[model samples]
Target chain A: MDFEDFYATSKDACLRAVMATVGSRQLAEETVAEAFARAWASWPKLSAHPAPRAWIVRTALNVHVSWWRRWRREVPAVEWTDPIQPPPDDDLPDPRLMAALRTLPPRQRQVIALRIFLDLDTETTARTLGIAPGTVTAHLARATAALRACLAPTTGQE
Target chain B: MTQDLHALVREEFQRVRLTDTLDDVTARGLRVRRRRRSGSVLSAVFALALASGVALSLPPGRAEPDSVRLAAWSVRTEPDGTLQIVIRDLADPDGLTAELKRAGVPALIEFKEVEAVTEPGRLAPHCADDGEVRSPLLLSVMVRPTGTDKRAWAIRPDAMPPGTSMHFVIFSVRDAAGKSYESVHMSLVDGDPVPCRSVS
Candidate 1:
């Protein structure tokens, strides 16, 4: 696909997953924005991959962990300074669910992001994470339980 | 439910900012635009070349040239048993030789520009006398010089008996600008040079 088509289809969807994993909108936007720059520079290679969305998400996730970005390389990116607040709307997710998700470890958050937001199955999630299937299931189970409990107590209030 | 989690995540993500994503995509799309343009141009050029090559290799107008060549070879045996070959316009002497050879007549052919007729009373041998000029196929003949190329030539068949061959053709072209009237004369008697004779 051309760059426009790929970006239009993938940008919002990937942004959501990255946002869920990083637990901060600013960082997620910055990470995905930079990841997309890198993807465009080498789109011919990335577009051929079986899961380009997974690849972009993984690259964004890796930047969050890669010491090189923190210490060495100034990877191509723009500083994201857009307003982060969502307008008040009933369609917004229950605050309790978002709060419950924030409490989980980063690995479990990644599993939820890939599995729930991105809709990858177990094997693809594991591959995206560079982890085994059992580990993905374990993290997914724990994160689900935590969210269930957090939602169970809340009755239409954050 | 799995659907619930998906819905919740998608909904919350609606909050994040997205300002210059379109500009970024536009920049990326520009990078590949050259590749597409160049590929189309190359295909167009290749198609043009292929079409021109096919058009160039086909034959030119055949009927006109063939008819003119046939008229150049119009001939009849004189009452004295000599052959009278009328060459009116420009004709390939080599082609005329082929026609004569096919008619069981062994002969030699030669072509010389009019400038070659310098010796007094010995001009380049062509049909100038009225009796020898039955069909003036051309009104004028002009042989223009391109470089230092020679205009005089001679063709003597190896098989013709130089002394006994009674039938031979000495067709000569003139030195005028347009519509050249050339002639070919053949003798019935043994002679080294077939003298240009009266056609009547």
Candidate 2:
């Protein structure tokens, strides 16, 4: 598809995937803008990539990992006390799951976000995050275990 | 337990609400391209202005050396569109925001020192004559506003020969939209009244 169409259709989806990875709306917004601007600058090169979505997602991820952004708040996990009124898109993860996801290491959080939120397979997730496929598996495994434990009801009811 | 975990994790994304914006991104993408063109044109103008400024200092008979000196903080626009503003003291410069307003830019510009650094050698000669600042004064030049939605760029105090502190002016832009964005444009100067050079 053309750049405008690609942007209209994929921008929000791409951002949500990144939001799940970065966990901060403002930072996510900035990252998305930077990536899209770069994409526009070199659309010819990027449009030809084998997996354009993967490239866009990877570009957003690269912005998150930038050294300057390293100075951003180091929250272990985000805490959401109230459920946001459902947006037009009814599909939102439970806050408990979001909190649990945030507690994971940033790398692990990114891996799980790509795998679960974007449904990227192992190789694609690995490519987007610039990690080895084996590393993706390890992170996924650990992240899955962590989420399971963290979200498990303490009373053993859930 | 593993099966249950997978189910719960997968469910989390099912109702995921996204917060990305397309309109703003689309607008910004276009602006980014235009800025590159403006930057190049401005560079050429700056070169021409610099060359002619030294050679054609004053017009023939009516020219006076007295006309050359200007107060620090006088706003001037380079051939390329960067606005050069001077910071003489701390608080808001009395007429700066107003002057900038007249330039078609809606801005509330002020100076807050993260750390104090003083350099007086660069002041405009006019300040010395008026005893406004003597011996050492900052440079001042004429600056004009070029457009709306212009990003506020800063000139950091340039490296001094000796005994001067080094600090950079940081211009953080908070547009009407209430979203703060930093332009790639930045300036580094040796002292006050230095050109707010465009580094982009």
Candidate 3:
């Protein structure tokens, strides 16, 4: 499909995917814009591919990950948390939960994002991350366990 | 933590709306591509202007200077419209042939020796008023249209004495039907000639 059609059909999904990976709205926006630019350059070559949307999404993710790594080299990772928003309250509110999520490891964050935010299955998440399905399952397991622990006290699971 | 985390992640994901706008993305992409095209055009125009200024400043003597030797070569094509040619100083006749062969062109290019034109001296009076001498020798090759009106030429910078300025010219030609294409000129100066290369 043409660029306009591609943007219309895939923009929301692409943005969500990037947001999940990068953990910042500004970075997500930048990465999505860059991905779309790259896709525009290769539109003629990618149009004939079987799944152009997937191609663009994968490209955007890769770009975001690469930028994340590069930026990591320049800046200390000690305070790698999202600066745009604050942590959640003791209550099980949506914003609080997101604040807590911003504390997870990068890979764990991406696993949760791709699986839950983008609503991709284990296999698709694994493929998107270029990892084995078992690896994806392991990351998801660790993420779920951590999140569960963080929410237990609030829900009176103790 | 699971329920809270899930809701939080969902909200965060929801907070991010798609912004890969066609108007913005495509506009930026097209702008970059057009910028590159314009850069090359500007470079070419600058080169042409420089070359014209150099050509205009030359002395208009009636005959080639005696200090330099001259040579000319032409190739004619059949009905199919394919012509190949190589021209250089007669002293270096085999050099051009060897170069063409090394470049994987056909061995039967059939180099022809036509009457020599007045050999412009590689050294000429400088543009400055100090009466400084400069080298500006030129060598040219042409693929003349046998029956058609098209003509292509490749002119090389003349090898003049030391301290002389060197100049080169390149050109291209197309047939009436536009199906036939030919390299009119690929030129070089002072030292060995390099192929056409562009950056940017």
Candidate 4:
């Protein structure tokens, strides 16, 4: 298929993949753009691969992870500097839960997003994160535990 | 409590879609498509100019004036009739020839003088020199076709600032039999060293 078709079919999946890894919608958009640029240059080869969507997702995640290396920081602490849409107020019922999410370690956050939000199976999420399925399980367990503690009601607040 | 927490986390992410529909994604892809095509065009023009200079310096009949310029070090023919070009730039012609032999291509390495192409000097936002950088220690090795004029050459970017690299350009020119000849070019420079690796 042509490039337009490829992007149309794969962009959201790519974005979800990046958001899952980076835990930020803005970062996900940036990573997706860079990955699509790479795919454009190597479309002939990438398009012919068995799993092109997976390839784009992997590349986007790698780009996100590599940005941290280039900055000499293990985590992407670079704050969003431009105008951002305010957090949607529709379905989300708790502000404290969102705050608690930002406190989790980046990898744990990724595991929770992929497993719980995007609903990827262990193996696919593992492949996306370039980790083993067992590692994904470990991260998920830790993330769930952390969230349970962080989001629990305090004696006075509830 | 565990299930409740999971539910909350899911609720948070699901609420955060970026309003990015397929149309938005397609527009982004089209932008990339334009950038890539333009990049290929620029590289093609640069390769043609470099190849033309190489053709002028060739001994009377050895060079194909109409051939494409490539930056490859060696070329090989596949069993299925596809051509594979290995790119490199070093003083050792014999090593390149050996690589071609291993790949089963009828190989010929000719040493010739050609002007090096120079970069335009604008730094990319990421600090990558816009890839317009050129140095003269460059060389080209054309792969002779056993029965056809079409061949692939490998390119090696040698000789630039420390950690600097360049890409060779390939041109598709048709020979007398309406067949295509693919030529590759590479740059080799002093002091600035090339990684002992291949750029595909």
In candidate 4 the C-alpha lDDT for residue A11 amounts to: 71
Of 2 and 4, the candidate ahead on TM-score is 2
i-RMS for every candidate (Å) is 32.8, 13.2, 20.3, 15.5
How far does residue A19 in candidate 2 sit from its true spot (Å)? 1.4
Per-residue alpha-carbon lDDT of candidate 1 for residues A59-141, written as tens digits (9 for 90 to 100): 88886565223222111011212234554545344566667778999899999888877789999989878899999999988
TM-score of each: 0.44, 0.50, 0.43, 0.44
TM-score of chain A of 4: 0.61
Docking class of 4: incorrect
Candidates by DockQ, descending order: 2, 3, 4, 1
Identify the superior model by lDDT, candidate 2 or candidate 4: 4
Off by over 4 Å in 4: A1-23, A29-59, A62-93, A154-158, B1-4, B44-200
In model 1, pairs of residues that clash are: B88-B137, B88-B138, B131-B198, B131-B199, B132-B199, B138-B180, B139-B179, B140-B179, B140-B180, B141-B176
Expressed as tens digits, the lDDT of each residue in B88-177 for candidate 4 is: 233344455455435443233333222222236521111123334444433222222211112333332121244333333332234345
Every candidate's CA RMSD: 36.2, 14.6, 22.7, 17.7
Report DockQ per prediction, comma-separated: 0.03, 0.23, 0.13, 0.12
What would the per-residue lDDT of candidate 2 be over residues A86-154, giving only the tens digit for each residue?
Answer: 344335556676678788898897787677656679998887777899999999899888887887684
Docking class of 1: incorrect
What value does the interface RMSD of model 2 take? 13.2
CA lDDT of each candidate?
0.55, 0.51, 0.48, 0.51
| Two-way DockQ contest, 1 vs 2, winner | 2
Model 1 root mean square deviation, Cα atoms: 36.2
Q: Report the number of the highest-lDDT candidate.
A: 1
